[model samples]
Target: MEEYEIAIIGGGPAGIMAAIAASQNSSSVVLLEKNSSLGRKFLLTGGGRCNITNQKPIKKLLNIYPQKNFLKHSFFTFTNEMLLSLFQDKGLNFIEEDEGRIFPMSEKSSDVLDILTDYLDDVVITYNFEVSSITDDFIINDKIKADKIILATGGITYPQTGCNIKNYSLTSQPLTDIKYGLVPLITKEDLSDIAGITLYDVVISYKKSKVKGNVLFSHVGLTGPGIINLSNEISQGLDYNLLENDPDFDIEIAIDLCPDFTREDLKEKFTNDFQLKGKTMLKNYLKLFLTNNFIDFFLAQSDLDGEIQLSKINKKSKNRLIENLKRFAFEITDFNRDLSKVTIGGVDLDNINPKTMESTLIPNLYFAGEVLDLHGPTGGYNLKIAFSTGYLAGLSASEK
Candidate 1:
């Protein structure tokens, strides 16, 4: 049996960091991964550009998480500044783009992975090592023994990236009822003609909760940051069984294309446009506010004619158009779990010690990454959590 000071399972961000932190001294730390290479899923983050972390201040960053208080210690231990400094010290430059998402200056996720693994020169990394079960006796793969253990197996989001590990009782929660997080929403209404249209500065709402950001009109429904965020909220509501029971859970999503304008404001704008171009087609006038493709589709929903002259437009027609422009409602039928950015639920936080990422029920056993029940919106928040928790777990295990 191969014995080591530390045995870290699942080589995603958390496990890698755990191994790195544990192996800082001459301690024997073995990182076991089911995949052939490390950071397989990490390569796919930020549309393959790798949003390494956010550049937000620590206090602001904490607000992005579900349990801000729980992550306070870990974030304080290894912050976004610490992460940036580590990579910059390793020759990997970063660039802050839209939404304050920090990415490698090279825009290559491979470069980010290289810097993370550079410190693993002396560590033992066992690829294709799928540990079936972990025993209290420090047994893994029914062969190895270790003084401390760290479980960083990610949640079941991308099976291709090896998150769908099975045949083992790794997490105390087990995360079976997997609902999609940060996924595109499916609408009952198909805006196929204008599916590819991208709208900036729009407000999307489901029930009383609303978020304002960019929205992408997909053939099935809506996507992008705003839509994806609402999906996460809905999924959480479902997990807590709040959807069916809550009287306000209508599942009807509203997109305010002209969020900056009130209904009266839009009405006035259109009324002024009508006066400016009296003989022009309503569709032509609407082109000033919306896309050419959306003009026809939006007109259909309002019981208005695209060919209707602005001069002939009535009060009722103007009111309907304004309403549609302000609150274009779509009945969200479903969201694709397979296409989600990550899984929402994981090992329950109640069983894990937030300070050390160690299991409360099992001594010397730590958990990190998506394996924990912590997730955030689709920026670089998840990656930051994974790295911070893993770092904490590594330090705690090494000390023990």
Candidate 2:
């Protein structure tokens, strides 16, 4: 068996970063990827443009993950600005879009992938290599020996990308609670007719939890970053107990169509509109606040006649209309059937050092990326975690 100083498993951002960092000073390193090509999933992020990382301030960037304190060392070591600079230093230009999302100037994920892979230089890349098992000494498919190994195999989010369903530490490590995060929800509302209707600046709330973003009507259900955020928060066990007994609990989230305006504020607006334009058709007045399809559907839900004059509506009916407009509820049956953005839980943070990402339980066993239990919502935060931790792990593992 050919032994190496370090072997980084999985070729995603974390593994690739690990290889780069490990080989910085001519340290022997090998990257094993099961896929025929590298970064198949990386090419799918941010609609193929690849939201490289957020350009948020150091303060905001540090608090993005659930284990915020656990990642303090890594985040500060390889910050958002540093991550951006790393790419820019390589002559790769990027553009800052909405929400501080940075993307390649070419606006193509392929370009981003090219830049990342180019950094590997002389690092050994073994494609189409799958390690069937991992032991104390490190073995790969009964071939190469990686004395010191960094497990960067991502979770089973995009299984098509070669992520194994088996949790590597199920037997030894206790906390490997895996669930999908940052995925679009499968809602109970059938807005097929109103599909493609976008509600800007809406607050999607499930009980005490809430997220604000544009909500898009998908044929299957609700989608968009706002809904995906709620899904991530929910998968973290925030509202997971709603299904404890039944295991198929139907949860409903309230969509505040107008987040800036309060329920009382909307009531006043509707009441005043009814008084001033009493002769105006209710449908026409509603058009100011809602989409035509929404007005049609909401008007029916309110049990009020859209064709009738606004002034003709009674006080009780007027209150009902205000409630429907303010807190429109939608049943979330399940998560997206299409693809899960990130995997939620992983090897517990307690078992690994925050500074080095090296396992406290087993010597020389390091972990980085989603496998480390550090994850966040979409828009480049998760990728940052992968890169930062991988850098630390690789640098630390190379040490004597």
Q: RMSD in angstroms, all models? A: 3.0, 2.5
Candidate 1 per-residue C-alpha lDDT over 221-262 given as tens digits, one digit per residue, 9 for 90 to 100: 889889888888777766342112321224788889787788
TM-score of 1: 0.93
CA RMSD (A), model 2: 2.5
Point to the candidate with the largest lDDT.
1
The segments of candidate 1 whose C-alpha lies over 4 angstroms from its true place after superposition are 165-168, 171-177, 239-250
Q: What is the TM-score of each candidate against the true structure?
A: 0.93, 0.94
Cα deviation of 186, candidate 1, in Å: 1.9
Error of 1 at 286 (Å): 1.4
